[model samples]
Target: MATIKDVARVAKVSVGTVSRVLNGSSKISPESYKAVHDAARQLGYRRNAVAQALVSKTSKMFGVLVSDVGVPFFGEMVKGIEEVARQKGLHLLICNGYHDATEEKNMIEYLLSHRCQSLVVHSKGLSDEELIQYSREIPGMIVINRYIDAIKERCVFLNNHQGMHIAVSRLLDSHNGVAYIGSSEDIQDATDRYLGYQKALEDRSIEFNEQWVVHCEPVAEAGYKAIKQLAEQGELPSSIVTYNDALASGVLDYLHGEGIKIPEQVSVVGFDDIELARYLYPKLTTVRYPIREMAEFAANLSIQLLEDATPSVSDEELEFVPKLIERNSAVI
Candidate 1:
């Protein structure tokens, strides 16, 4: 309950001296600093972040908007952001929208109202114009795993195309035909991954077959349903590549129940090498997304944009390439 004034009174110094000492400003003398520290310890004083923000026009807090907090990929990214934020002596406010556009918008509004210095958005919920307008008004804003054309915002994202290329290439090298199980033509990333799948097929002289491709939501149930449907249609491929590990796990379960062997009968590949990939009975072959790197880079860039006069990145498109992780699920 000790305030700056109480510490200043005990230290026999001006309130400004106490403020400067708390901010670690170099202007304070060593004697003043020592006295202020002793008084602070004696009074059990703590700096009031809210008051400091009001005076300095900075909340010293940042917002992180992600698609789903439960997803392991986002968890790693959050950790990376937290690590950087902690190093910078700033706080992070996380908001999970479950991939809902409306929820993302609400979260943005709430963060802005609280005077967050910057925003690190990692979802595809808001439009370019809307984000640009917010950036123009707020201190700084960075987009992650998504792109916006109107704003010259720094975006840290994955190379979905290259990741899928590796997945399909692995499947084709080891097996004859491969099937894709993920979102339909609606989601942007899913479409890009599907295109990567097609490119891999064309590169290796493998004929493209529509029957072998199945579109489903990015969920385990969707994977199960897609496989059952494919079984009924009699067009199951020798191998399958899923959008994420969740669907891949579901596919593995369905195949096991139907007396189908994995890799031996139908090899499988997954994306976003989540922690569960290692724990699974047969380790999952997946694409290792640089989630931590992306998150930290984006967080630091957002801070820079807020503190410096220069913009973070003038270019509109920025991406991080995913690396292939060979494991037990897919054929060697």
Candidate 2:
């Protein structure tokens, strides 16, 4: 029930000075700010956020729109973003698009309309033009994991090329040959990873085998079916590298059911070291993506953009190289 006027009177400052301190304007003197805060705390003063937002045009909330919240990769990134947002005294408004392009577009528009301070998005099907238009309007938005050339400065992604190179290198050296499973080759990440695999094989003077590449949805069921098809054809490779832990788990489950030994019969490696990787029957060897780092960086960058920090928008898109996480699934 205590008001700003009461705090100002107690702190021996004008209401405007008290307002500056509460709003984090950074223009108030330190002594005045401390006194104002003390008075507010003593009086149990609470801010009317709805009224403040109407007056100042700021909600102090950030919107996070993800393509698939069910994915472990996105979940880890959200954890990192949320941590940073909490430190900055900002609230997160999460929206899950469930891999639906229409839902993603609608969510983006809705967040902006609600005066979200900024937005961090992980999209699977948004077009480059749509992204650019969205950024042009809000201007403090960031797209995670996927790259849009038109909105280059607004995107942050993983170093998939290097990750695939590392994965393929281990497979080639440790086994005579390897196969790829999960996702269609048309997808940008899948294509880049496939190219990296080809490049590594070429570097080692190993012939590229197109037959070894299996394209499907990036899901456990897809991976299971891919392997089952290979088994039926009697075309199993000596080793396999998967798009993510989901696919790897599927492969492990399928192979185990068939009484096929892992690493001894066929080594398996995966990308994205999900939490389940370490808990699997045979711990998975995978890529340790800097998801938390990337998420926090993106969140902070969005805040910088919101604050009109000129150089924040000047920086190019950033990518973090994933390191291999060795475990029982792949030979050291």
Candidate 3:
């Protein structure tokens, strides 16, 4: 309802003086600044964010693109990024790509159109070449959970292969019949984790069997159906490694319904170490994904790139290793 012109007229000062005062320009005298503030408060005047951003060539806003905002994994990642963004007096512009390449590209373009100077993206559908092109276009763009050799310096990712390897190794040590419930998504994480499972089996001289592996969507329902299918086919293993904690929860529920005692009949291990894993009846033994830490690092990296224009990645931060968290679900 109020404008800068009205404030200037009411304050008996020129529009330029009002503008200077609003922008916190030190050139304005104390008298003019006080008068402008008093008039703005009386008139209920507010500064235009878009106009100010245009003048400064940037906004105090950061962008984040995630697969799904509702998923706990992305929720934790956002929390991490938001923590750093809040400390910097910046706001976040969050968008969900829903694991679609076209949708991911659109979200990135939207953020760029809004003049977002820094971005932390969790993209699984976009190809390496497309992501590389984006990295070249935006120096402040940082990729999380995936790696591209061309833009390695801008990537904050975990060693999924090593994580699965450790999980499978622990399961195989005490159980001869080990199975894998993997994600059917055509993402790098799924592929690397499957390979890790195989590698761990090879290390222990255990023969790999395709029948023992089940691939489906990385969700609780898929996990439930996969386990049921394995049971029907008479291919259920003595122990199983799941793609994530959500899947493990489903397996636990199905096993419990069938009156199967965990660690005694069928041991289960999961990845990501999500909060739900701890609350499960037979608390999950899992690999900690450290998504929050990686997201925080990625957010800070994006800001550093904007500030220094030539940001360097530290060895410690770039390559995060997953840790094994033993719990009630698995046995020695």
The best candidate by TM-score is 3
Kindly list the per-residue Cα lDDT of model 1 for residues 1-332, writing each as its tens digit.
68889999999999999989977899889999999999998996655343345467757787888888887888998999999899988888998876667888778766765667767886666666766766665556788886555653566677788899888987888788888887763556787888899999999998998887788788878888888888889957789999888888889889989988877888888898888988775888888877888888888888887668475464533577788898888784
Each model's lDDT: 0.80, 0.81, 0.89
Off by over 4 Å in 3: 1-58
Q: Judging by TM-score, tell me the better candidate of 1 and 3.
A: 3
Clashes of each: 0, 0, 0
Candidate 1 Cα outliers beyond 4 Å, as residue runs: 1-58, 149-153, 311-318
- Comparison by TM-score, 1 against 2, better one: 2
12-75 per-residue lDDT for model 3 (tens digits): 9999999989777999888999999999889967664434454687688889999999999899
Task: List candidate 2 segments past 4 Å from native.
Answer: 1-58, 312-317
Please write out the lDDT profile of model 2 over residues 1-332, one tens digit for every residue.
68889999999999999988886898888899899989988996756543344468758788899866778888998998999899988888888876567898878766755667668988776777877877776656888887777777778888787898899897787777878885773557787787788888888988877778787887888888888877787768889998888888889999999988887888889888889899986899998888878899899888888667354444444766789999998764
Superior by lDDT: candidate 2 or candidate 3? 3
User: Which model scores highest in lDDT?
Assistant: 3
What TM-score do all the candidates reach, one by one? 0.78, 0.79, 0.83
